[model samples]
Target: MIKPIIRLLLIAALLAPGSAFADTEYARVQFCWAMGKFDHTIYFGEVENREDRQASFDDLLEISGIDHHAVKCNTSDSTSHRLARAKLLKDWRDSEFEIVNTTFLSDLDY
Candidate 1:
């Protein structure tokens, strides 16, 4: 019983940090998607609500404490292309967190 408890504690210790790191990575990917959207909006001369987008990005950066320079946005692609890529990234990011959460919860027998 003591050995089983030790093993469980070790497993929890190992998985705890990984979950936090995965959350940070998810936030980083979200920031990257916002960056892509910002670039795409500006690339097409859509300045009507540009300030709003900028504010949203700024808010996210401030809240997440993530460096804006960490992720570079691709400006070579057309706005539509960028939007499509952003959609794919969003889907991947969402699915990844879902899997991580499910696995983590299952591993803990929760």
Candidate 2:
């Protein structure tokens, strides 16, 4: 019984941080494309908000410096893209307009 209790305590301690991390909110985003009959998808992970998302994309463009005419936004809004889009709009600010992805990073990092 003592051994079992100790193991449980250790497991709880190990999982505590991850559980707290999950409780923290974030924006999850993804990108998809099609080629004839084939399709491809890429996951961009979670981002903070619209400005942060734009900034991240801009940073990506700056580093990789690719010429992409448009940036698609998603959250938990549109039926097709629900949860992520909604989170973006819920945290919407006038200064920022769109979100690129969501992050599991802590609020401070965001």
Candidate 3:
């Protein structure tokens, strides 16, 4: 039980957009590849511009090649087979983008 939890945390931390992996073209590709290969991953991004946020979400899905729709969900769920809305968790100036609620996975996905 503890092992699974620790592994999940480690995976999340590794995939997270940390200072070590700045958002660059190569970084985006690497992130997308890692995300596609991982069965479980949750990504959150903060951008001030709404248009940029939307574009980022599109890129995230496109680069990762995950086919999905916006559903309603929360962070407390232990299962990934749930519905959740993809919206900003906080204010618009600092938006939160989640791409973990995907319904369809491309060939590249795990």
Candidate 4:
């Protein structure tokens, strides 16, 4: 009975569109790989929900910390892409904490 219920839940998740990505916002920004440099200027105006994009951008800023805490990006381009990881939690317990996956993109290939 438990197996059947678990299977049904998995099926439901797969059938739901936008369910996983509903609150998962994306942004296009200039980025460099971990240990790399940030001298490029990529655009980030193609994301959806322009009215609410700023909030997402702010979230990204906190995740990357701009010139502070940042993780390795997921893209090979390095000049134009998306952040590989993010941590939205303002406060988390030491034992309950986990590293947010990091990813990014750029355009100039620099």
Which candidate ranks first by TM-score, i.e. highest?
A: 2
Clashes of each: 0, 17, 6, 16
lDDT of each: 0.28, 0.32, 0.31, 0.28
Q: Candidate 4 residues 1-110, lDDT tens each?
A: 33532542443343332223323344323222221124221112223222323334334544544542232222112122222212111221122333232323221111
| TM-score of every prediction relative to native | 0.23, 0.27, 0.24, 0.20
What's the residue-level lDDT of 36 in candidate 4? 14
For this target, which candidate reaches the highest lDDT against the unseen true structure?
A: 2
Off by over 4 Å in 1: 1-31, 34-59, 63-69, 79-87, 90-94, 98-110
Candidate 2 vs candidate 4, TM-score winner: 2
Positional deviation of residue 100's Cα in model 3 after best superposition, in angstroms: 9.5
TM-score of 4: 0.20
> For candidate 1, what is the lDDT?
0.28
Error in Å for residue 25 of model 4:
23
Model 2 clash count equals: 17
RMSD of 2: 17.6
Which ten residues in a row are the worst by lDDT in model 2?
A: 33-42
Model 4 scores worst on lDDT over the 10 consecutive residues at 84-93
lDDT of 1 at 57: 39
